[model samples]
Target: MTEENLNTSGNPSIQDVVEQRLSRRGMLRMGVGTAGAAVLGSLSLAACGGGGDDVAAAPAPAPSTTPISLNFPAVAKSTADLVTVPAGYTATVLYALGDPLNAATPDYRNDGTDTNFETRAGDHHDGIDYFGLNAAGTARDVAGSERGILVMNHEALTDQFLHAAGVTANPRPAAEADKEIPAHGVSCVEVRKVNGRFVYQRESQYNRRITPNTPIEMRGPVRGNALLRTKYSPAGTDTRGTINNCGSSVTPWGTFLTGEENWSGYFARSATDDTARGGATAKSVVSLARYGRPQNSASRHGWETAGAADLYARWNISQTGTSTDGTDDYRNEMNTYGYMVEVDAYAPAAAARKRTALGRFAHEMGMFGLAQAGKPLAVYMGDDSRGEYIYKFVSTASWDAADASPANRMAAGDKYLDAGRLYAARFNADGSGQWIELTIANTTIANFANYRFADQADVLVNARLAADAVGATKMDRPEWAAVHPVTGEVYVTLTNNSNRKIEASGSGQQSVDAANPRAYTDAPTAATAPGNVNGHIIRFRETGNEPAATTFAWDVYLFGAEAGMDATRVNLSALTADNDLSSPDGIWFSRKTGLVFVQTDDGAYTDVTNCMMLIGKPGQVGDGAVQALEYTKADGSKLTVNARVGAKPTSATLRRFLVGPKDCEITGITETPDGKAIFVNIQHPGETIAKANIGDATKFLSHWPGNAGYGAGGALARPRSATIVITRNDGGLIGTDGTQVLNGY
Candidate 1:
């Protein structure tokens, strides 16, 4: 459906649209921390120096065998039936939504009568990472290791089913809404496999939840800016919590970096206040607008009107005091979020920090490349919105192999994150891209007519403004970026956006360019409206395939579509049910196994089945020929091109491994280097399960990770966001052959 024809009632408004544009679309047919150097000064220094000397050697390469075949049998349509995998494979649920976060709290009741969410694991787990541990319980790299710490992101909650009684659109008592806030954050769970079965260490000291209540420090250029000075921290040195943490990355030094995305919609702002504060400037207007905190805008949960509790008041972004001073007001509270938060998963005592140097925006996730001591570090990130820009952060300091020690972990982050240059991606029409630096004093950004900048903080906080000033190339919604294992080339998923059209002459805000070639009207489908629907995956190889290179060559890797969509464009890959998917999001490449995992969050195909994940052995870059793409630009001129894209995957090389339940997303993947076991997260299963019906097991849409039989109650009894373990049943390599083998190859 065209944007004009779509209804906008319950739909987010323009302001929310700005915030979510980078995040929202399916293949449419038609469609860290600091701390305590003093107390244990001796202990700290000793631990730091001691661990640095013990660099573990890389594990021996696993024996190479014939490629494994992959295929699956469709099971029951609705019930959470065990996935029919190749005969030698097994899948087990490791952790599920609502599991207790601490040993001190009561375990999950699964009966839907429990309400103590303060200590429970959050719902809708998203991005995650696996950190192997040494035999001594310290974090280390262990090849073929079964024991490690799995740090997972609890992106957000599906509040509709979080409580015993369904939540009212307009609730009377605000306390009912208060409980859900604390449950949204990151969960660091320590897990290990014993006797070939994965199990979480419930009492592990490292098991901790970093929630909205956790105190976090602000770091980088924007540290003490007036914009971040919320009442929670009058000095702007600290903030209460992190929100909307979607995807994440793990550092070589053993810390977790969770990205805060879509954090703007949580607060209530006054429209008049925003207009009065020089919000007309592109920096101010776009900042507030992009974040969805327009003045007078209401919150989805209405927490701001809930009373005098600091907890509720914190959600208010309205300017309350008469003075222009921001102390009593929250004009800048929203700014405190939308950052990359660094959390020490192992050190519960350490507070997390918002690494402002990364540049605040709708951050999807950060991915790092191989590290060398004393060498500059490189990180790749996506803005997660349509028409937004992609970014990379290159650390100023060289890596120090010694920094991997437990004691120097935070120092390692500081060494790398403290002072770094941030650059935005500009994909040219000639299959090449450049990284434009967003520095204030040394560039055209400082001389922009609109916003005045005093230092780097302004440029970092108002990065979009700077990018605009310098004229960076706008992209389709960029999400979940990863570096190719065999080649250091980077790939980003530009999920579909219906608003995009092909521009002929003059450029429009999101006019289609060579980089984003496809532009067409989506056909009416069962689950999706007719508009620009099915999206495509874009891959770029840095000059010479070097992760640290500032220039790169790119191409469209895959175009998503229905099994029988347009043969010319829609079905760019000629994909079948075995591998076709819309709105590709969570993506990862296993460096050790050279396996590319693709996950989908599609409304377009929901009429057929739930979201799914697929595995592919992608061919090397430059493996395909150029193809012609046609579209109509905003200027009403038609544009056509013959551009190169990734080779299409045959059914034999790519296939769906699993599908999620009602209203759920299949995301957050990590695998052992050996490829023996894969960890996948199912987020918000049965998300539509009404609160009133939560007590009735049969009424719930899903009871996954629990036993397949009826009424097998336990932790998994409740429909929850959870992580599952998939392994070969016969204790052999996964996807070893080109055909369906293990089961009966």
Candidate 2:
């Protein structure tokens, strides 16, 4: 979420594995069902608002088997301050930041005067999932295409725009902190198709906001552990709120899993805190440094400096009280974060649970694999940092079809998510990869020299260390992932990495590896952005078509490059003007049409166009041959990497769908059951406004939807993060002719 690269781990880079050149390999067995979308199969679950045990369940319509193809013309790339879709499609604003959810709440006055964000729409909408509602709008209806509930994560904020004249300096005012803290969690809003368009319900009973002040239970092996003890919860059984919620996942039983990312920056540590905790060699001290919270680090929002109230004081991780067990101070407050928080949207009164068995480390997206009738479930995740590793957690209990529409969804999460085996990925030069288990029983982790493991709880709480001990392959900022609906192969987006170097720039700098094979800068805006200026997407198929497989085959699915880049080197995917993109961040596959959507959060290619989203038809892994790319090192040495890449993309296969306004990122998209409409979130428009010029709208980078006539119009409107619904004029399926799907693969 933060543009700054915070990874200091000197683990072996993907370039290290490419140099081996062991041997070529075959593709793994892909699954028969879908990952996130259609894996629910024929089972249908009601939307939120249905009582826990009274919700009705139905079956969904079968997916279309028509061949995949792009039906509409591609929209030309634009730098204009509005969402640009194809000619036949219409984009309508559905929900915006600070929009009131209750009838008692006043309408949003977008000029930074809004309050009680706990009852309003949060900022920076990220990953989202659509839960369909019945025609009556009271319960979930997997078959209901006209209405549903959208559960989305509010990742972070553009603080400069939160107040009337930007944020106060140093010792921040509690008033400013009060509004920002509640805007950083997740929101659940009910939306319906009204008179041929989708609009959010202002007074739906299912609507709720899960802020940092909400009550959440700590579940799994790490619950009640001493490391989680703090003044707020001496028993360590519960914690207050979830912060920096990023990308999300929807379970087969209809629960939402929100990832906690970039949370380490919110805790302020005193310069002498390491000494207070018994020296730098202490286990707690080592963990603090490893998680990027070294001594003297300042809090991100200065919430800790806003008086001594527990709400503000909890942000400070300094040991101030006299108690030795951290029961009297907030020393262990940071430990309560960074895990996946599961929310039952159907049950508004239920407390969200932090599932710790999944492990914690700047989690980006927790993607589920194909859910079978009686097989173990698997969740794939990325750490979302420079030189971080990909991980997967396989549940110990096998899946039961009855749990698909359980009376109590959180109870089902307890059965599957509470106990699991976590594994880190290691890519081989020969196009093969292995998933190394991260458990206390593993000799490599149990006898790690860097940090000794006390038990399974310690291994999971400090998962990065266990991953490092096993020599996992470091990637280029892996963010969001998507699994194919038919083929079942997993695709992960490796967003650009500025820390990547042709030759080592410093002790922890990463070099070009086989997996991350590019280290070139683009002309114009990205001239200074060397080392994979435009990121790429890599996909792999699990061995034996099983989510719990330990071995798999992988290849670069698509390379993120400019249309004019060198084809033999940087433009490895053979991209054209219509399909070229940069820094692929959010990704998802349409269960109805089998089309994968790619969104960007980039600074590398902004000179030519604003960030955009693209739609494409994906092919299976190992569909292309391995290519050799040569690069010159800093010392005048030549380096060659044999990168296994997938099939080339064409105008027919991949094309830009929508381009966002200035200084904003195109993120979080989901479609209706019939694929007739798609909801997209536009985040942080005009975010480049300087702190001194916050109240001056003329100096704002972009006016966005407001200037385009959605909310408060005119030249003085402040840009607000909002959601838009896209639908075809002819009432056809999105990106396709209603009766037929895309014509190309």
Candidate 3:
């Protein structure tokens, strides 16, 4: 039989909602770009790649707003599931899903028999940061960006492919359970350029894999709280490692913050457990339903029933006991997750932390304002789910230069992440927005019927309830966010929402609003779902164009669509063949080049092109005129709202840079300090294959980096998500020029 004939079920064996699945704007680093004449927020200079010109060595004034030029012509969109780069640039795979890091670990056999995954690379590479380590490799070396450690989050795993028997089987095998446990989390590896190419150090002192079994310290408002107390950690001061780490950010203190997303889906609950049990209340049911984890919901993979021990059972976050307190049960076990994990990337051996003061929700990612001498530090975040809200945490203490490159990075996090005000966003229809503080002091939440706020910790743990109480704007899956390099404006990608519908009294749907205005059917994911398929990118600037300001103005910067979608509806950006996308998931500003990089994680427009990354020069907030949008209300009445809509993007303003393989998202973008090299990650490339056929490597939906020539010779390519590096063949900086903006070729 042919390789494709032996395996009959080639279609994707999707779980309940796939169980899951799962920048800069220009200043210099994603947030470290220059905003207007002043530099906006920035990650630590030692954070992630992209450092050239030794500004830290000899502090100089900001560079002039000179637009950078692109030497290569834009590549045409392709149907092949492979990494496509512009002319004159080369793309090389660095680390793939099952690749080994330490010398003790053997090379991946591609037979799903690989063990000790805790020491090997994880699956589904996502957000990443590059930290320049000193020659001794003990501390953050800001002066050098060429030789640094790359910290990437393994957002999720492609289960069926990870096991020999496939993961769809009801009772998960113990061996399969073991591999799956270590497959999710973050990876830290050392990478450096050789004579002409960048290479991954197989064995480096800094190489480490943080899996779900690793110990993580819990700090901030929810730390040491009774609600988080579980049988595992009665003190509630710590929790088992982080999971679903999607988009991530680097702190100014040189620590990596990985956001835990879709964590609630991993835990299972009983159908009859809605009544008071353990420490849960009626609000628990309401909160669970709102978060899409209603009672009786099956766990992501039935990990609880995998074995008799709690190793896999601990994943069941449902109300498991009738005890007055949660200490004797795992009911509150899941609450300890769903927060940002702080890792000292420079010190791979350091204990990671869960910063709860930032609030608990499906944290997509976090971005910080440029840490100024005397100004307060600001961090922006998003909740990646349907009808979720955007958030920001402002540090109470003032910024100090001494804290920038601190002697102890984690200690610096203690001063900021531990004492901050967590606030939810409320985008007004008048083009203005407000940061609603999620505090017990807010009357709307303190007396909320669904969930009462007994303390600050209660307010944060039940943050979703508080956001609903305060009437925060319901967004369409707020995924990754970015802050402009020079405008100090925050840009968030509202990936499409399928649950939205026209307002009807009994419909119980999310109606179109100023922030999430589109509700048209172009290529619906399903017959019943037709709201925002091709999503849009929204940008906002604080009242004073400063992150310190709570009030701001917002506008839809760019709408994602197919090249020929109706311009009056979905394709609002007027995207052409050169620049078109859907569900923009990852976004960043190359402050080093004044160009904005946008990536798509969508199935909405895969028919035309695989998920790709586009480069553009974005304008500041309010660059376009206000748009009056009409909507159908519950009574079939016309409801019009005004919004600061963005202008259509011309070919000169935006162009496609690279596209990924089948059933994958183009994510995790970073460039070397000198702007000579760029790194991007391809996630879950042959995801469409079924469990039964996953073992048949030849029949896999995609051959990926291997078929693309990054893998072994004549070997059956086992599709694996991996990171690839991009560099110029001419040996110049990776962009064309004029004023650093990637505007026109």
Off-target runs (Cα >4 Å) in candidate 3 are: 1-66, 135-138, 276-281, 504-508, 524-529, 630-643, 712-715, 739-745
What does each candidate score in C-alpha RMSD? 9.8, 5.9, 7.7
TM-scores of the candidates in the order shown: 0.85, 0.93, 0.90
lDDT of 2: 0.81
Ranking by TM-score: 2, 3, 1
lDDT of 2 at 562: 84
lDDT of 3 by residue, 1-745 (tens): 0000010111110001100100212333222221222323332232221111111332232444434444455667777867888878888999988888888899886666678888888999999877776656666665455688889999888887787667757587788888988899999999887787889998888899898889999998888888889888889898888988998877766678888888877788887777644234666666666565767878777778788687887877666666666777788887888898898877766899998888888888888765555667788888887777889888888777667667898998999888878888888777888998888888877987667777999888877778877778778788888865444568899887775555422223466777887777765474455677888888887776444687987888998888887765566677888888888989987645556789998877877778888887677676677766566665787877564668677776688889888778888887665666778899998877777676567777787867776644223577889999988788766655444331110
- The true-versus-predicted C-alpha distance at residue 236 of model 1, in Å, is 2.0
8-94, model 1: which lDDT tens digit per residue?
111111111211211110000000101111111121200111100112334232333334334444222222433334455776778
State the local distance difference test value for candidate 3. 0.73
Q: Report the backbone clash tally of model 3.
A: 48
Per-candidate clashes, comma-separated: 42, 7, 48
Q: Who is ahead in TM-score, 1 or 2?
A: 2
lDDT (CA) for every model shown?
Answer: 0.65, 0.81, 0.73
Compute the lDDT of residue 585 as modeled in candidate 2. 93
Give the Å shift of residue 544 in candidate 1: 3.4
Residue range with the least summed lDDT across 10 consecutive positions in model 1: 25-34
